[model samples]
Target: MRPTFHLKTLVVAVAAFSVASIASAAGLDRSGQDITTFLQDGLYAEAVYTYIDADVTGNDNAYIGGDNNAYIQGNKTGDVAESYDFFRYGVKADINDTFSVGILYDEPFGAAASYSGDNNFVARGDLDATINAASDGALPNYAQAEGQFDALQQAVADGATLTPQQQAQFQALGSALAIAQAEQATKGEGTNVEVRSESITAILGMKLGENKNFQVYGGPVAQRVRADVKLRGIAYGPATGYTSHISPDQDYGWLAGMSYSKPEIALKAALTYRSEIDHKMQIAEIYPVAEALGINPVQSNTMEMSTPKSVNIDFQTGINPTTIATAKVRWVPWSDFEIVPPLYNEVSKGSYGPDGLALVGYDDDQWQVELGMAKRLTPALALSGTVGWDSGAGDPTTSLGPIDGYYSAGLGAKYNVTENWAVSAGGKYLWFGDAKGQLPTKKIVGDFQDNDGYILGVKLSYQAQQNFN
Candidate 1:
């Protein structure tokens, strides 16, 4: 029979060329042709996405009334956080059509890990025995002025050993070491868990008109911040505790944009701006059980924080030839954020007195609004959807953390095959709104609430061909 049907048609063409070479080495047709050129170029290449999607959700609340016999008698609750996701993969090349360059390994920023340990607005144990009997009635006049400056520094190291009642007790221990160094320069240095931050950003884009759709670039942006501060709670028996582990501050900012197109009704518009990079962090203020129970010797502070400044405006139109629609807006001023740290101006100029001032001073700000739509059920299939709205900034300062205010929804899909491969998938959902605050001082008590989160993303791509002539 015709040589057994030509060896079964060469074993079905070598099993369809081994499943198209394992779907082009598993990058699924270059992430489905970069999600069909990012939904037909209407997603305004969110800062040039070779493939990136991020997510995070967080919330917090607190309430305590002034001295109604020190209120906050339980029933205060908050917390439901826990949602963060990130996935990135980028690449751009054209090195010759008036120049081009790209590299955007994403994960721009992330953080969302709940907290509410055994609720009931924590702060019980008889309120630490009534704040240790009001801090031992305000530490016996600052420990009798630190025992008259330790008996005049042990009588000047035992020199001038004469006595007229120890020179009136060394002038009352130099008037109690000048009032305990002026009340330790205004009571500075006290922390016990509060709001914190986590971050990540990578950018690289370069291009200039004449066929690359106008461009300007910038690079080098790195950040990693973590803070858990808490002050005033163990009253007079166990308070000092502030854990911060920071060391990831690499700055150098830049980013500029411009785009306009009209491939015959496949209109497009873009505007990008990313600038604001400042991180002089170097914190390692640990107190791991007060340094494994030997107490004090874990200090490292170097602060100067900044991560705010973003502006994006994208617009796209092409309601035919495969459908497309997009509109985006973003503006972040994060209330001109501030986290001074260098002893926040020497604890507000009193050198660490007045309890070392600065319990947390934030001025935050934010804004966002996006809408998207895409469809192309042919030459390789495609689909997309997006919705966003985030607005709410600063007003909750109990260490000013928890940052609530959001409402986002997303979904994406793509699957190109030839013309340089492609494949992609995305997901997002954030709806957090409900945060109250009041705890900058007044001896901590309780009231805080927050909840909502979900996000998932993926992408892949590949393009090769450009032998300029």
Candidate 2:
């Protein structure tokens, strides 16, 4: 004998546990890029707020010069992971028994981190010290030729003629001196990075099958992205004193998915794919080393960036008349994503050949999975619990966010304010994996271990069903 599920009660079971998973998973994933609102059996709307705080601490590599054998753990890095928060809103309506429309908004991908204290990540010493450290004692050579270099520079300014050889020497000396001065000016500052983005998706769905049990949906997505980065101190060596600002840019992409549901046993499953968005954005960069490579140290230009494509699978089934089980799986090809600023790429051509390198990149894709259960304890109250894991982009990742992945457990509860309104709250604790931080040059620069963090979220939602038969 099969136990029949009351549609109203089953709706509560399916929606009760959604708050517990997908926050701070991996590779800049936030809000899980969820679309569950459109899968509900009735008109549904929700607003959610989530906050996350992480304690990421480790040791900076003392050997900033990049010799592996001579490398030693340096000073404590303090906590680099900053607290982050965001909001999400979703609304869905069934236009008819065979059609539906929905809109979803969320902050999908982002990062925030700051480094302080006596570490390689922070600049140290006075002007002279900074100059000497940055120039590898080459400051003395410049000091020796200060008189000649100055005379040649002033002569050029005054339209004086010189031999081509003299002109070459003069330019080389000036660029070296300028880079040292730039380094000295930034002395005593710490490293920091911040990235933010927002997305909105509009979707339309049409039902299929004899019982109208299956649905296919497609949508257009609008996304906005911006970021700022500053790399200071000896930890970055020649690349120290580098900064980039990516102005906000909006672009469009697409989303497609299919879902199946059976109200009798409260069974539902959805598989969704989101296409990558390409953004052409204004960028400003200040690279101290650029001058030394015969390129201007300051530049403002346009760069093209692609966020990354992803896929998600969400499933839920009834365990009993009052209990439901759920599972979520997500994949992102982070390895295919990277940021390469123009001036930085041009400067790198002197050493890495024509291919150059990206300012940020990952070596592997990310995979995340979470399993959970929800139980309706009363007609108006429900509780949920979940356990999750994420395969980080990779170990030896960029130092900006030096974490590999995480193991997490979460708890949530929902209370119905009325038959159609409800409030839910959830919290998750994460145990982060150990990682060795590296520079874009493939130099191991830091070691982070035994780190952890937490996430908290609250949501208010409304749902109303209509009889279509």
Candidate 3:
């Protein structure tokens, strides 16, 4: 007779490895958009917190001010990747043998990075010299202009009547001086970028087939997104001193999936697909150099954007009464994603043609895979390990997060606090792949090599299985 394996015996083993360890990836992927909580047996609820710290350093190309084609080694860029953290919450319950519902919330996409130190990414230059150069010697230096403006202001205060032509000249000088002063204050500042988004999904699942072995689920997803970006210093060449802010916007999308399960051996598999979400956002942009091209330097507009769609496959099966194996695969077409702020796109049109260029974009799609194993050592204790790999969007990617992909190893443990409550902790070490950082114009600006990072996460969960006869 064959040995009978009980699904309940390995519940702890599977839960131990359920904590996600992926906090960063290509094209702003975060939280992994996981929906596994809904697949758990019985009533399930979990809250997970994850933190990511990355050490990403490199050298800016030595062509900041000279020939753009030069690729000489330059100053060290320091650690530009900042530390980030977020939270995820999920709750699922069965209404009956044939119906179920779940609600999940997570930060689905984001990025944070800042550049500093004595690098080309940091702004540096004499205010007067920059003004003279940008104007091709047509505009007076800051000192000269300040002196004339001060004299005119004193004369006006002394009740001296001025001609309309003189008044116009004085107003122009004042505006020019103000712009120069503002730009001067930015000296020594570095480039920085931060993007954040949140998503909540409500799902309804229906059981099908004999013994209810197959299930299908669909849901409506609500997502909110916002971002801020700054490009300073010569590393950006003609694009320096550019800034943009995307106000928070909320949009809706949809998700659909199907799953199959064999309770006897604890076998389960799910394939999920998420639709793209479109957002109409209010964006404000400031291009310090726009005046040189005869266009207004400040602009505010309502722009349209769409986040990419994705697909994920999750699989797990019992290896024995005490162990379970798991595998996950994910795909995202990042190359289709782009952020083209109005002012930035308009400025680039002078060089990149009518369509212009995107302020942020990718060159390829992304694929991620992971395999893992979990074992229940005691009735209340379980341990798990996983190995993962990510195929980044492409090399010569954005300078903000200059990594191609990564290889990772993770370890996790879970302790049952009681029959209905448990806590899980996991950590993953990542070895990042080397990549060349490029601007939107396809100009290489930095080379990052041998970079690495780590992810840490904790999950608090509750589960209560219901038995039906």
Best by lDDT: 3
lDDT tens digits, residue span 191-258, model 1: 23423333333333444555655545444545344544433222212222333555665655555665
lDDT of 3 by residue, 1-469 (tens): 5555688788887877767655547989987899999999899999998888989999988643324345768889999999999999999999999999999999999999999888877877556744443333556477877787788888899999878987876765665554455456578889999999999999999999979999999999999999999987666755677889999999999999999999888899999999999999999998876675678989999878899999999999988888899998999999999998999899878768999999899999999999999999999999999999999999989998899999999999999999989999999999998988888988888999999999889999999987664
Candidate 1 segments exceeding 4 Å error: 1-255, 269-271, 277-315, 320-324, 327-338, 341-369, 372-386, 389-401, 408-447, 450-469
In angstroms, give how far residue 57 of model 3 lies from its true place. 0.5
Candidate 2 per-residue C-alpha lDDT over 1-469 given as tens digits, one digit per residue, 9 for 90 to 100: 9998776775665666666578754677777898998888788999988899999999987652326434578889999999999998999999989999999999999999999888878766344444444444555444645566788978989999989999876765655565556656687788999999999999999999999899999999999999999988766766778999999999999999999999898899999999999999999999987876668889999999999999999999888888899999999999999999988888777668997878889999999999999989899988999999999999889998899989999999899999999999999999999988888888888999999999998889999986777
State residue 99's C-alpha deviation in candidate 2, in Å: 0.5
Q: Estimate each model's TM-score.
A: 0.30, 0.91, 0.88
Error of 1 at 363 (Å): 17
What ranking of all candidate models by TM-score puts the best one first?
2, 3, 1
TM-score pick, better of 2 and 3: 2
lDDT, residue 135, model 1: 36
**TM-score: model 2 vs. ground truth:** 0.91
